[model samples]
Target chain A: MTARIGIVGAGLIGRAWAIVFARAGMTVALYDVDVTALDKAREAIRQSLVDLKQAGLIEDVEAPLALIQTESDLRRAMADVEYIQECGPENIAAKRGIYAELEAVVDSDTVLASSTSGIAASRFTDQLSHPERCLVAHPVNPPYLIPLVEVVPTPSTSETAVNHTMRLMALAQQAPIMVRKEIQGFILNRLQGALLNEALRLFRDGYVSAEDLDKTVKHGLGLRWSFMGPFETIDLNAPSGVVDYGQRYGPLYRDVDRQRGDDDPWDSVTLAALDKERRERLPSQGLADQQAWRDRRLMALMAHQRTVTPS
Target chain B: MTARIGIVGAGLIGRAWAIVFARAGMTVALYDVDVTALDKAREAIRQSLVDLKQAGLIEDVEAPLALIQTESDLRRAMADVEYIQECGPENIAAKRGIYAELEAVVDSDTVLASSTSGIAASRFTDQLSHPERCLVAHPVNPPYLIPLVEVVPTPSTSETAVNHTMRLMALAQQAPIMVRKEIQGFILNRLQGALLNEALRLFRDGYVSAEDLDKTVKHGLGLRWSFMGPFETIDLNAPSGVVDYGQRYGPLYRDVDRQRGDDDPWDSVTLAALDKERRERLPSQGLADQQAWRDRRLMALMAHQRTVTPS
Candidate 1:
């Protein structure tokens, strides 16, 4: 009686999704165009499950991996599946082809979700016969550790599509948010862009060094942001809270926005400075080791969050 | 042999700062224009210290509170102090007047820093004879738990003033970042604004609910961000890590910026939706209690972070 899920494109993201779904007690049918990719993806998914098990993230991993089956036929993956997660490439033409193929074969009750970051659901769903079920359930990279899945819909998309997608995502052990309309980068990407843009502006203007700039977030504002949003954080900022903090500091942010009109810091001077500072702190050779350490650290953090709060 | 740190205001930030400096083993002299404010501030500081003790944030409250001495005279607060942290009103006229008064009283060797969030250092330090000693030392709302202090300097400001202030902040158990030149909103505010701005845009454009927007951060990015920074986070994102992740997603972020023209959803509407969601999640009458819960949760999270990670 468990929900049966189908995942197209058994690459890194697709395999990750397979793990997520299978870990949540859903039988996943993962498919790829090439049989070689399907073979490799199965091994990768197994290895990743082992990693997750080692990190104490998953239990009964062998059962989940055993539940995931690969079929030579594309339509075989979607047959009798309650949900389908499409982690196809960013190309519009490829997505169109896949959608067309999927629409022709996917079950009427199946929720067809795209893992696309930028493409609007309307872009491809405009031609779909069952466009109501088509939406973007884009997840941040390494979705297991970071569980923000942006569920963006189009005008043709139905409310049931949104709710069912959310419910199915919950079953997958992912936090799903509905995007009422289609936007460029969804939510997480755009929010992330804002920070990167401002960091670049500060560096380009020669206001701070790259290392200190990063530290400003890691040691300072980030300390609070790790727990609360900007709005809630601002609320507790002043005596009267949000309104007071806004009245005092809104003008300052407005001025900053004014001063930061269309400035790109990827130029030679700024890049050189960034490289210089980056080299001083993190060597190119040690980048790999540092990254492994970061992943381990993230694993530890995730373990802490899971045990302290709810996983 | 300890740093003689003089604070010009006795408000919450200033008092918490007194605890920070005193706990770090320094002589903190506090002064206020109104004795009534000072008296109330004393009670508030004592209560806060007790709360910190209860929260296990501070170890010895009595000794730290004992290190603070009240002075009625401006010269007494300004004289012979290694560093002066000005936490007066953010109004330009008030700061200008204080700068003039402190200029007449403070020795040239003493560094004069402000806790102003809005006004630039150049604006208030324009007419001061020793403007070289003036700089911005902005901190988060509660400086004790959150240790980020943004140090801003004008073009005419001396390097020695910057270095001395940095050293002094270090002595106070604060992580200070020096803004090489004055820019709007400094580092933390701008980065935060960037994220909030994009969130506002996504909401205004009918992309996501306000609650979902906040969760995108709190659950998604905030998980790792609580421990590492955006740059460091990105560095470990891809195979080659940050540089690789940047190369992959940087262009995509730029494209997102290009698409967010003035056609997004409005903040007021989103805020209304957020308020509605907030009320549903927690009764409006219990907001104050919820905020206490939030702080306790933060403390628990911090404690968990310590047990999980070394740094």
Candidate 2:
């Protein structure tokens, strides 16, 4: 039997989730309060599936599109669904209100997950009667193309809920990591934040330009990172593996950290400088076109990754 | 007239430089003190060129192969070359000795560059007679495949030398970023180190496993990084631009930074655990095979990149 999944938002992320679930042969019930937003979501999901088919990431768009159904009523959307992925706003009050309404209509057994990037599940889920069944299963933007999901669980979340979420994400072909504790920005954003903080500092200090800094990643460090993570990269770097690599470079990293200090380096002055350079390269008017280019490139990269077997 | 390039040290990196120069229609003089190493380097260069051709990274192997010549005499190898890429040992004494010999043989007009992964150019090039012409042109390992070259200049290096090196790297189809001031690890390793430090902390704290941590990169953050860098990525992320993105997430990044105080977290216990997991995924015996896979994948990615222009 096809599993029924409820998506409780029709924004960009919500539509992407609909495609992911539908493509995986699940019956997706995508719900939105706004009728116009729901209508737009239907068209967007259809176009995204077509894009996936054109990129050779999906076999055919028809079957997946057929599996997705739009629902206007909140109660009907929650009806008979085993799992519900909430893709609402990033506001704590908005999420809390939605959860309160959702808890009343949904079965106690239905696993509830939020797609919040910053807010932790504990903040909002603590108010729910069945908080054990609720957690945060945050997916990267455009989840249909990129397959990283951070499966974060609150303290009240049951083991069963976390395990089931992991299984469902794997079924959808998403690489989900179990984030044991709810850290700020989760794992992806934190790691990204670390890199961005340093990048801003470097740019502000006049060490390198915005263009050159980007080049340093795309052309240099990013090449290896495309296949391996930081740990594995260093693991393969040294002769004796991770320990040897640590011994050689740990102190140097310590020195860098000392120089970095405890303060956040994301100053507005640096951002303005970054914005000026970015605008020079790509104006605001051209952003939509550039984003489309990014999506196409991402699709092509995904297609290429499918061809190579992971080590 | 084709530019002449001299590659000192016929090791793996040296051979890779030979390919980069030769493929760009430059005459290459490859040198090594050991005869057997040079013979092996010649065969390796041939095989790598063949691999690149098979991967569609290069048009034809014959043209590039024709441009490379192995020379036994140091003076003959350095004769009239416009640029000399030194891929010698990381040891200070060894580099100093090589620069002394190279300074005597090579014309003062030639731009001398080292491929040291960690040592700053100022440390080794300080004693040289023509320090103004010397700089560090550190390329990621296997430069024939990866295009990032850190063109680092010492305090004594002249602007003419730096500009010429940048021009030469661009001609060879390698992406070169200028390191305005000499810093530890240059740009690539330092950025990599920051991420590694955080990753170690996460793994040690039991937030995520080694395998899953790598997935967070290869499957998620790394996908976008392979093409556009973090800055450009955030630039296009929000509606307004990078400034808007900063406004939304800068505070969150600040929170994460505070939590991650000044501490070097690459502990031995965590490394041992990571090593164990890595060895399990890729046993020591299987490393050679995995490395081959990595090279092949890099070649394929490079080929793909050629098909699409950066946004």
Candidate 3:
């Protein structure tokens, strides 16, 4: 049975979600509050689908594009949809209103998931009668290019909902990881946050330049990171395995941690300095071109990734 | 004029350095204290060069292999070498002893650098007759595959040595980042240590599983990090650039950092748990095979990187 997916906001993420599901042969109903945004979304999604086809990421883009139906009417979009991915505003009151209307319209069995980056589902779903179906299904930006989806559930979210979402994501060719509990920034951002914290400090202290620090990742740590994680990186570092690696380097890490000291790692002065450096390299006006460059690189990487099989 | 490079230790890093310099058209003299290790280094280096050639990373393995000469005597290897990369043991005494010998044999114009992972160059080079020419030229394991070389200089190290080393590294097609001041673990490992520290804590607290955390990177953040750094990622993340990204998410990172608390993030309990998980996924004996797999993936990524122009 082909499942129907509802995207309740025709913004960047909502439209991306539409492509994700549509590409998987699911029927996607994309809705937005503004009629103009919905019209714009249709053209943008069409162009994006073609781009994916050109990149060899998808074959026969018209089939997926045909699967997505853009509608301005919220209730019509929600009706009979087995899953609703809310991509609305991040505000609590705004989400509460959206959820209230969604709860009234969608069936009891419909799984409601928020594409919120950090907001816990419970905060907004607490008042809903069907909170069991509500959870956070956060995808890294530009989900069509990146495949990771963080499925974070609230206390009230049902196992059925979480499992359904996970399975659906997998079917959509997305790699979904469970977040057992809620924490600020979730796993992806937290890890990124940790790295950024140190990077900012390093730049602030004049230990390394912003460009060099960027090189440290692009040309160094990130090469391994693209395919292997931190734990796996060390697991293969030593001959014996992870335990051997930990035994050898744990103390060094501990020593560095202590030396790192407990200070507010993020400060405005450092950010300003970093901003100046970044802007000098990439002027704000050239951001769109740079983003397109990033997208192209991502497509190339994903294409290359498909050719290699990991042991 | 092509520089003649001397490798003091024929270990994993030494052999990898041989490929890096040799492939860049530099004549390499590889030496080790133990004659057996030197022989082993030659075989390993030859095999590695062939692998890189097979992976299409190098055009002709024989050319680079022919450029590398294995020597059992230290002075013979050091004589007339324009640059010496010491891949000695990561212990202070061992490195100091090696540096003392190198100090006597190498010319004053020759730049002496250590491939020590953790030990500071200043610690070993402090008492040398010419401390100005000595610094840390730390490369990621398998420099031919990973091009990042953290060129760290001590307080007494001369600008001439730093610039010379930097130019040589760039000439060797390795991305070299300057570490203005000596710090523990330098920039690469410290940033890695910071990420690993939180990863340990997160796994310990059961916020996410070891595999999931790894997935969070390989499938997500690492994709971008593979080419762009955290600062650049955020710079493009928001329309207005780094300052804009900082303004929007700086508070969130700060909040997460506060919630992170000061208790040491690396605990033994978590390492054990992580080890179990890693060993389960990849058994103790399978590490070497997995490492080869990682190398193949890295080569594929590098090949793909060469196709695109970084904006």
Candidate 4:
């Protein structure tokens, strides 16, 4: 029998999740409270599928499109699914209400996963009867092109649920990393937040311009990082390995961290200036067009990634 | 006449710089006080050229190889060169002595640039007779593959020198970003240190494993970063643009930064643990092989980058 997957929201992420499951040959029931959102989601999903097909990421868009069924009724979407991915709003109250409704309608055997970027599964699932089956599977934006899904399990989450989610994600051709404990911002966002903090600080201090800082990354660090992680990068950097690398440059990084001190670069004043600088480069009117460009660039990169064999 | 370039200290960075200049059809005179280091650099350059040829980054290895001439004498290497890329050991005193010697040997028209990763140009060039002509043109390691060059000028450095160096780097097909002011760790290392610090904290606190953290980067954040930078990323991420993104997520990042507090994650204990975790995955004996693999992956990525047209 074909596996059934339930997506509990039909927003951007929900629609992307539908493509993911459908591309993996699973029957996806994408549900939403708003009829207009469901309609928009269907159109967006179709456009994305067409983009994916053009990138050679999917063999036939029609096949995947045929597999997904959009429904406005929550119970109808929840019925007969082995797993449910809750893609509701990031608000805790909204998540709580949705999960409660999902639990009341779905079978006890059905695993519940929330697509929260920072909120822990425990926050919403702790009051539920079957909290053991709930976990957080935070994904990068546009999960189809970017394959990383952070599988975070709360203390109430069962080992079986975690294992099942990991297997399912791999089956869907996504890279799943286990976050052993619930931490604020999860893994991906925390790393991004760290870098963003420093970047903001640098720009605020007038040390470097916004454009130059971006150049340093896209043309420098981001190149190696595209293929290898930081640990692997440092491991291969020094003569011996990670230990040698630590001995050589660890102190320098330590000094820099200490020097960073307690300056909060996320202050509104700094952010406003940053926004001003960014606007100077790309006005607000051009954001949608630039976003489309970014998406196309991501698709091209993903397509290229498929051709290269990583050592 | 083809422009001549001098590469002081024929080590890894120096040899890579030789490739950068030579590949651009410049006559590169790679100089080192140690004869053995020069010979080794020659062989390494030849091997790297062959790799570049195989990657289709260069049309012919022999053409670039024939352009690079290794020399044991500094005076001979400095003669008739339009610019000098000093890749000597990262010691202040050594740099001071080398610059003093270089200032005496080179013509007033020649631009003297250093490949010092962190040191500001003023640190060593202040005492030189021609400090105005001296600046830092720091390149990412293996410059031929990763093409970012941070052109940082000291307060004493002249605008002419900075412009000349910028033009030269661009001509070499490198992405050059100007550092408006002298700062610790420049731009790249500071950003890297921030991320590494956060990664260490998460690992030390048992929130995530070393391998998973890396996966979050390589598979998640790194994908978007390869094409678009953090600023541009956030700009496109929100529907409206940078201001919209800041308004929506700025508080969250601020909260995360504030929550981070002043607890230093770069202590010895954390680093040792990080080293242990890394060695377990990539044993010490396999470092050399893995380094080679990293280079090949970088080559493949660069080769792939050439085929894609970024929007």
| TM-scores of all candidate predictions against the true structure | 0.89, 0.97, 0.98, 0.97
Per-residue lDDT of candidate 4, residues B1-311 (tens digit): 38899999988899999999999999999999999998999999999999889888889989999999999888988899999999988999999999989988999869999999868889999987789999999998889888999999999889999999999999999999999888878899888888887888888899888888898999999988887789999888988776777777777777666777556776668778887888787777877888888888888888877777765
Tens-digit per-residue lDDT, A129-173, candidate 1 = 789888899987777767778888888888898899898888777
Indicate the docking level reached by candidate 3: medium
| Candidate models: Cα lDDT each | 0.76, 0.89, 0.88, 0.87
Tens-place lDDT per residue, model 4, A1-311, is: 28899999898899999999999999999999899988899889999999989878898988999999999898888889999999999989999999889988999979999999868889889999999999999888899989999999999999999999999999999999999988888888888888898899899989898988898889998988988888788778878766677777777777766776656787778778888888888888888888878878888888877877765
lDDT for residue B156 in candidate 3, whole number 0-100? 90
In order of lDDT, best first, we have 2, 3, 4, 1
Give candidate 2's root-mean-square deviation (CA, Å).
Answer: 1.4
Which stretches of candidate 1 lie above 4 Å from their native place? A34-43, A50-56, A59-63, A70-72, A238-246, A264-273, A307-311, B73-79, B103-106, B238-247, B259-287, B308-311
DockQ of each: 0.46, 0.76, 0.79, 0.72
lDDT of 2 at B90: 87
Best by lDDT: 2
Q: Which residue pairs overlap in candidate 4's backbone?
A: none
**Candidate achieving the largest TM-score:** 3
The sequence of per-residue lDDT tens digits that candidate 2 reaches over residues B1-311 is 38999999999899999999999899999999988898898889889988988987788988888899998799988888999999999899999999999999988879999999889888998998899999999999889888999999999999999999999999999999999999888888778877777888888888888888898999889999999998999998999999999999999888767888766686788778888888888887776776788888888888778777666
Q: Against the hidden true structure, what lDDT does model 3 obtain? A: 0.88
Candidate 3 chain A lowest-lDDT run of ten: A257-266
Question: What value does DockQ give for candidate 2?
Answer: 0.76
Alpha-carbon lDDT of model 2? 0.89
